[model samples]
Target: QFVLPDANLGVIAFIRLAGIKADQLLKNCPKEYWVPGLTYMSEWSHQWLDYVTRTSGRLTKSVRFCDLGDFKMSMLEREVTRRDGEAMGVMEDCYPQLLQTVFLCNASSWIQVPWRLLRPIMPKRVTSKFEIISPETNVHERKMLLQYIDEENLPTRFGGKNAVWPVHFPLPEN
Candidate 1:
């Protein structure tokens, strides 16, 4: 079976079942910057139906924008496609497996540098207790900072088990 991200996988499965040859070409495709790590989330949910449809040659699906009091989906959508004219797709079931494989094959040295270097840059005030800050808030800035460090620090490889960098954070005193 072909393992793919949820949005693409679902579309491919549907197309194949309908007797169509579908190729999900993502080469040089635009990245969805607004929704960070969305490809790591589940793909079979209804919320991502429009994204799946748009990317899989099915653009007729209705697209609605919702506001969550503080943020609007339209704004996020615009930001996603702002860089490369591409939007984010929903996550698939195989994403975790893909990450596991990626983690195993990449070089440990490449993974360790970012984690080690970023420790000093992370806000010292960001304790574990106040972790629910919005992406629009200062807390969100820290989250992005950490995510950027991790992504840049992770190693990319084809085939081999590699050790991941250790994340060291001081525990809160009781």
Candidate 2:
């Protein structure tokens, strides 16, 4: 995920699905790996909470932008869903409302399948923050994204002017 340069409106963590390799992910990442991962995220979330509280008070929260372009059903493997559910559960238990919104863009109807499965496992507060958008096809969705995120903070590919975090950039080294 790439953090947008503009922080006037809070952090905007961007993620794109096009670069993911389903087979490689499943082969490489085992379910046992996520527990420690969630722990690390919890630590990070606490730091983020402290930072947001110090800067803009407790009400401010970070948002996520998930670009679903080129998303495939193969990416929704059972292991993936299970890990995601665990992660969301951890977030709810520890961070609570740390994430203000999750903008899902360029999504197709196929999203319903995973949403249906995952929604049942997620709490209302967590699920409520999600905003499924189709900026590629629907004008209303695009407007909604722009309403939440300003054009200058968004990448040009996502209808913004930020060239530093382009959609096609090479993945950063971990």
Best candidate, lDDT: 2
Question: For every model in order, what is the number of clashing pairs?
Answer: 1, 0
Q: In angstroms, how far off is 45's CA in candidate 2? A: 4.7
Q: Rate residue 159 of model 2 by lDDT.
A: 62
TM-score (all chains, Cα) for each model: 0.19, 0.72
TM-score between candidate 1 and the true structure: 0.19
Give the CA lDDT, 0 to 100, for residue 101 in model 1: 10
- Candidate 1: tens digits of C-alpha lDDT, residues 15-131: 111111112222333344323433333233333444554567753221111112222222333332443222232322333211111111111343345545764677754222122
lDDT of 2 by residue, 1-174 (tens): 534343434455677776766567768877787766756755664565456567766465767788887787666667666776887777678767677788887777889667868987999986888977766566676777785467665665566666765443332232
lDDT of 1: 0.27
